[model samples]
Target: MSRVPAALTALTMALLLCSGSALAKKDAETGAEPNTQVPAGSRHYAATGFPDRLVASPAQDAARGFSVAWRTDTSVKAPVLEWVLAGDSPDVGTPTRITATTQALTTELGASHHHRADITGLQPDTLYLWRVQGQNTWSAWNQLRTAGRADQPLTLLYFGDTQNKNLSHVSRVMRAGIKAAPDARLSLFAGDLVSGGDGQDDSEWGEWFAAAGWLPQETAVAPAIGNHEYFEEFEDTPQERRVLGRHWPVTFALPRNGVDAADTSTYWFDYQGVRIAVLDGTSALDLGTAKAQAAWLDTVLADNPHPWSIVLLHQPFYSPREGRENTELRDVLLPVVRRHQVDLVLQGHDHTYGRRGEGQGATPQFVVTVAGPKQYRLSDEARATMAPVGEDTQLFQVLKIDPSHLRYEARTVTGRLYDGFELTRGTDGRKQKTELTQGRIAPRDCTRAQTLKGRADRCWE
Candidate 1:
């Protein structure tokens, strides 16, 4: 913001980064408070000429093609992206080279150029080898595959709120999700990829990248904007503006097909038979974009071409915590998705797991999950509305879906099944869900009644 001086801003950012690094060590692994905090040095992932943070993003229609984005220092001259179909022979065909579009991103540490190259006009279910040119060298070729037809069986990896301990604890959940669903087409995130409270911290973003490693390069990632993603708008500061972190735009290169206020955060992508409509609840509640986003979501779902519509957002229609009463959010976006018969709604920000709307066969099944080390207690109000809730655990979800049915499994970071369910679409479009909790782990919460009655067997210690 012009209201804040550059020197003062940098000093504040440095102090915040140092404090954040220290707080990261004090995690919420157990239900009780963690008593640990060690001072850590400021971690600035300074960029170099060689390309880093290379990620592949899905287009509006992933079946047609995808996009690749990477970061390089300013010295990288004429960065380009080269691509060719993956074939039995390594040198089967000549590569098509495209010059990348560059955007200069200046963080608290320094400045770097983020480049994105869009690859379109490709066939579906095809594998391709793509690489990007750095300053003087080229990144290793990565494999990318497009979505297939509507009837094709699709697997997807869904995560919620890897907002803290990204490198230390969240990395295991990310890799486990990939391992559980190796054939997954799109890796979708509900929100809060980082936990930067003040503003953009390049170090946190770097940890997220390192946690995912080659996962994003191999598969496309679609992120719904969370509350934390929106930090103080100082990068483009005129002060008093709470905009999304500057890293989001150039980092992901998502489709610009949503409402005007939050285009990148609130957009949709079609893969096979699924249309993932991403909404920005933070923008809706904070920036007064609720009315506009509701209308846009109605329009998008009104003309939906995909059979299975899954909506992704940071705030949930139902919260696992009592005080997280997002009545405004639910009032605006809930009816739109329900009216359009959205198959599933994925969400985060509660730091817990909950499943609701399974009774009497609801159109959009609501699921709130957490994938990081942070934990939160489930409230009695939340427990009354939602079922099969879990807290103080890191979890990831793997969904196998087709136009007819969806098989959902929630697994812990150590590859243990925590919750399971299946939803089958009826001929008239309503889905009937069957709880498949035969082999699921015990319910994690210890109820007050069970505790008062001294029923040790009814609760998990």
Candidate 2:
């Protein structure tokens, strides 16, 4: 027998070892398992549809109630949820079971069922474990904590436009935000959760839910309706003629205190002395519902008994991007918000970070932020008016509110604090705002040399 060359043998062994190492690394990164029995006509990510995308939202009363939404295969006729007060161990069994209201629909990914269950009678400041039962399987037990008393302090995680490049880019920021603010009572999204319109794109929604991990199972989510959430009659049609996607109302179990059944996306919920109101900007801008929503907003704010009020919407009254202004929306909603003395207005859709109302006494602080990978140049107007204009950086905001003070911090995707402030209320119900950037990292700006590199530029260090 002829002996093989030693160098050739070594090279072959090295190649095999490198291939094995790469496979191992990929597996560790993805936690993906092989499925040999992928069913026919099922998308790669839609196999089994075994109760995925589980999310918890605030019910009518967050302190005593919570709502959960999940998806399963269409075969599941009667979905159910079982919950119990979580003890110290997973051995706790046989939780109270409740039937979930389900809606069956066919999407681009095929036939699927969406289930929502409103679990009430929960004790405030208590932890509970819950799981959903589908056609023949039950989801793993997920734990959630109820809202505390009105006087208790509250922390909330805010993200702007997790619309483009959700899984590849935005997932890290979502995970980091959840890790950094583990005690946050709720997660607030400033609209454009997905880039696709009319819910025709299942992959984007899948990336969004998958990136969120256990957040939806734990903290409640309040998402506003962005323009991207609406779809035009055809891709060639004008944007102002768009309509609300069918999936918005069915996927989220939000509060129903809006103008009408079709406008339920505009609603409000209170938690720990703070009332958060979400408005459907797409509906208001495109469907001529601005007047109706503004009336509803006034009513909600007038009836609110909380110490702090935060309004969330997609379009900003003070446009952050140049040549992009929603004067109609601003004209109608700004007066109502000012009349009610809203503390903060979180917005998105400009794909940049900006702040207005800094020196205006008693005026609501308006913020525009972007959390996804997509970036846009600051409009000339934004550069002239907005402070700390963030262009190339993905960001998230951590907000803490108490009876006397409200703290706000904006951080990059890599967990660096970029901008922050503190708002203190005086005895006369006036607010004194203070910037909290002492010794903190400065804002990031891209240089001319870096800008030449196109999207590959790393503007912020």
Candidate 3:
């Protein structure tokens, strides 16, 4: 008999204890009671572990094939998801079991596990009710809708950074972001979902999921690996190699198209009429990302034919913070984006908000936003690069892409539109930008260094 690895043995013991407890929770409506308590170190959850913050709800892949992911307290049994299309009646429910899988991992804080289930085989542009089941106990099925077809126009949500106070203030920002774009087809998380090393803890990751709720499950999500996604390391290359990026791939199954040199986590996918390219700025700057990822990115962009291309990453190529600009990534990837006519670049890390117009003949527009509780100040150099900077605490953005034009709006957490613009791409082969009739959403200058420690302040003047 072969001996089991210590980690596997520990996880198995934990899972068995958890399964016994799951068998005890009586079906609320069924009223069938069980006799055991939830095991120690275990919690019942939906475990949408695949993609963390981004949702590909109206995914343009198969007719009605949408994907979802979550985490679990222990090593779970085989993933068997049951789903049925949701109709006019919310009560409509029926579940067909689909096979899924789980992967073991150790996050920054400790050991952890996640599960991802891709639900396919459904009608086009329709809603579906789905839930996860492990150890014979199932999670509540949630409502999700598929994409309207390739030619259909769609709306998506883009936030700056959601890395601070995940469950409290940051959650409000996310909820407000969701409410602001109630009909948004999907969301793009441009890194900083948590504080990176500190946020990699099992509970912090859970808080992030709890904050997003069924959003990531219902809507399709695409997340970028930010600086916070990595641990605090010195010059230990071997240690860094041993600590390969975590929780990302196991949490969301993204389309494998972006920078292949990196993990599938940093990839791109097209939904409806838009092409989204995800880049790994952190890897490119510190790791050996420039060589491998750059080549893959060039190929992906060159081959893409989507009408609009948006690149997402953690660091800003053009920033309000002059010192923080990613020159290396800019040198390697910017030309690709320009050559491929990339439409937008969304990023976070400086914690401030910014937008800069790409040079002549280029359609790519750059934006930096803060989705988390933390914020930063826009220095004079940072302000020189960007137009209106959001240095104070509250900000987010919503992007609506239609057949005629693409609309972008920057808003406060409470649903007030501060900045707005429209990008109209016509047969003339030029994307004309129109500034909308909205007030600026810049942060007040009254903030001080102490109060804005983790957040950005109003230092642009």
Per-residue lDDT of 154 in model 3: 85
Q: What's model 1's TM-score? A: 0.89
Candidate 3: misplaced stretches above 4 Å? Answer: 1-64, 88-94, 106-112, 233-242, 441-443, 452-461
Say which prediction, candidate 2 or candidate 3, comes out ahead on lDDT.
Answer: 2
Tens-place lDDT per residue, model 2, 155-232, is 999999888667777889998898788899799998888876422246567778878888888898888888877777
lDDT of 1 by residue, 286-338 (tens): 88998899999999889887668889999988888767788878788888987
Q: List where candidate 2 sits over 4 angstroms from the true fold.
A: 1-42, 47-49, 197-200, 235-240, 447-461
Kindly list the per-residue Cα lDDT of model 3 for residues 1-461, writing each as its tens digit.
Answer: 55677667567456644544454332223453222122234443223333233233323363458766555545454667678767677666566777767677753224445566677667767877777765545667677766666677787888777776577666787788888788876788888676644222444566677778767766767778777666644336655442334666676766654555676547766666677778888778887677677677777778666677788888888777545657888788787877777888888888777778776643677888887756566778766766666666567788988666888888888777667788998886578888776565444443565441122243311
> lDDT of all the models against the reference?
0.81, 0.78, 0.66
**Largest TM-score belongs to which candidate?**
1
Arranged by lDDT, best first: 1, 2, 3
Write down the TM-score of every candidate: 0.89, 0.86, 0.81
lDDT score at residue 108, model 1, on the 0-100 scale: 54
